[model samples]
Target: MSLIRKATILRPILYLLVVCSCYGDGGGRILVFPEDGSHWINMKVILQELHARGHDLTVLRSVESWYVPQNSPLYTSVTVNPAPSSEEEDLGPDFFSDLMQRSLALRKMFPLRRFLEQQKDTMAMLLTFHGGALRVISAILDDAVLVNQLRDSRFDLMLTDPAFSAGVLLAQYLHLPMVYNVRWINAGEAHMTIAPTPPSYVPMYNSQLSDRMDILQRTENFLRYVTIYVQERLVIVPIYADLLRRHFPPGADLVSMQRSADMWLMRVDFVLEFPRPTMPNVVYVGGFQCRPAGPLPDELEAFMQSSGEHGVVVMSLGTLVSALPKEVTEAVAKAFALLPQKVVWRFLGERPAFLGNNTLLMDWLPQNDLLGHPKTRAFVAHGGTNGLYEAVYHGVPVLGLPLIFDQFDNVLRLQVRGASRVLEAGTLTTENFLEAIEDVLSNPSYRDSMQKLSRLHRDTPLAPLDSATFWIEYVIRHGGASHLRTNAYDLPWYSYYSLDVVVLLLTPCVALLWVFIFVCSRLCCSRLRRKAKQD
Candidate 1:
């Protein structure tokens, strides 16, 4: 063969070898600290994706964790002892059920009084929750053996849910590059922490206001924003104050440590969230957990098919609150009975007396599969983020009965987009529930709107899960993503807001104005004196 032909063959061989070598690259070892409950569900999806991509993972969970198990093929689980009398460790369906009942009662009070009482209740909850989270952090830090083992593990990065600050504290202690699987931080939404959220338009978490606001609405949002700030500073921050003082440098604070994460895998897509300022390091992996529907069990498939052309409605209240108040459940059951469509509900408590033959109750149902099925028309939901996004993924309209926490805001987003309707679970009645369901089922606009959102959500170049995994690996490859992180986190509040620069700039102008006034006054005095002397 000629020399040119030989060289061409060698080039192709070398390229093939290079491709094979890159494909076989060994994965990084990752340390994960996850929050329990629905948050763990989100984290586990990402972990599964990472595992498939050849990454090794180690997960930390509390001994009394409700969702996280001791064994999983995905990662090695390290269970830690929670603090004695830990409120979070003791949290169960019954606790949230009581809270729902209290919320319902509060809703019946006078508006102003109800607002005050709700704030008081929310503050108490925050204190208890954060206090429990702090105890877990203290437990981990207090253990010399665990701390040494963690340090010796030589992990590439810490991937954590910042809903509790335990992961943030541990990542900082280990001096690891941190990536947050976050929607909420210690105090409020993660965006409020990392982005420039102007209260003029950006609604506070739980505010339930849209991006467009009238004057009074804006005022309410502003107050809510201020309340969150106060809660964070006075309530949540102080929970970690003593720990920071003992383990961290002077002036170290929880918010700053949280903001220092190399990447924020925000679990909100713009399709579902109101437009707001965001940081570069904040990657939106919303609906990352959703996937194409799998084959349903034969019995479930038969039920779905039996609905005929009328279709089916799927309902789930999420992981935390297994069942709503008894009265509310009865109202919902009666409403479901009135629907021509078959209803599949995930109900954990006693069967409602008013339930109809059209409705089927299961302790649990295949939520994603049901939503994706062609027979599935609308979803009755508690407005949990996971379920809402899944509905969006499958283009199913939602009739939301938001009970607590961010559920209200989650449903409101879909309502604003014309994909869902919201009803106050506290005031839910058979008549109103039936009316809303009828409206959702009869209206073609709701399904059309949700389908549009699904298109936009699905049109991304890389899948949300892949995007999340890629950035995580990016941080691992580069050791950290400090270049992508903004320096604003290190700035003091005044500096971050540019208040110091404003004062500095205003000082010279103020001095000039005073000088000009003084000179005029002196001139006037001289003129007056001359006039008097001349007279």
Candidate 2:
């Protein structure tokens, strides 16, 4: 080969070598701090992938860390004692249960307005409590011994899910390079600070409004948006400020600490979400937790096979909600018994008496495995993003019973896209539940819609895991990837949107219009005077 040809052939090879050399075989130590319980499940795939890539990892254990299997990789595990007493164990569960019970209390209120009004009361009560497990964990990290130990560990990077404020605070305390994996679509003040989620167009969390809204819906969404600041400003900000004053370094504030994160791996994609402006620091890694279907356990396989031509339906309400209310369980059980398809439901505590011969109950099931199976017809779920993304991955239609948080919004998006129907858990009835299941099962359109969305979801050139891993390593290689940071975070809302500029430009136009009006009046009066004189 000629010199030019040889050089051209070697160019890409040389680049690859240089890239590999930069990142190197000796990967840096990574510390992962996921909030307790199901939050860990969301980050499992990413952390597992990172561990497989030879990065040294230290994972702080919440009570939920016991779920990690013994055969897992050699990552260092530390169980943090946030409180000396047994009380800390209950804090996480209590925080969630308190919010849920308060939400459920609105059932007696009878109307949407009353529900929202009662919800505000719940928020007020929730804000007054400062002993949440996440806050306690942050305090534990602030302990002098723990802080000194973490600092001495010389961790090159820290990864955390910012469900609570602790992750950001902990990162700030340790002065480590940080990356956040936010597992929600609309991360309250965080997205508002980094991205422009216009309230008129983008729906607020739990608002139950679609992307395209009518006048009333837009007004409601705007009102909801305004209320979001009440919690952020009144509750989250003040508490974190006190935490900073009490435990963390003096120089850092919440906004700056949050902005300092190198990259935010968000669990959202354009396939399911409305198109909106996003900053460079925000990366959409929606299906990071989804995986190819593995073989089901023998009994499950046999059960699926027993469904015959009618196929099977899988129902799961996700990890946080282990059991539904007794009446709700009976309603779901009644609906499932009527279906020709076999049903596998995830339930805890006790099986309802109404459960039929065609249905099976388990405290846990291999959800993704069942969804990917050919015999699976539809999914009945709580519309958690994790489950929704898996359904999208496997091309299964959904019947969503949205109970709380962003589940409502997830189901709303699914309904808009013609992939699912939603029923409010509080007001759900046996008849409505039965009709929805039949509609999704009997109609081919739901399946077709889901298939189309699944195609779009998987059509990206790189798989989500690959994309996430690349960016994560990229951050490590480049020493925090500071170039991706946007100046938008530094600007005030009015300045960023250029409201002042709009007023400034409009001033000249208004002045010119007045000048023309005055000139016209003067000319008319002059003509009238001349005519009068002439007369």
Number of the top-ranking candidate, with lDDT as the measure: 1
Q: Least lDDT summed over 10 consecutive residues: which range in candidate 1?
A: 15-24
Cα lDDT for residue 499, model 1? 99
Give per-model CA RMSD: 4.7, 5.5
Task: Give lDDT tens digits, candidate 1, residues 414-505.
Answer: 99999999998888899999999999999999999999999999998678987898889889888999998898878788997899999999
- Residue 264, candidate 2: alpha-carbon lDDT: 88
Off by over 4 Å in 2: 1-23, 62-74, 84-112, 118-130, 184-190, 247-251, 492-494, 497-535
TM-score of each: 0.93, 0.85
Residue 55 C-alpha lDDT in model 2 = 84
C-alpha lDDT of all candidate models, in order: 0.89, 0.78
Candidate 1's C-alpha runs over 4 A off are 1-24, 86-90
Which pairs clash (backbone N, Cα, C closer than 3 Å) in model 1?
none
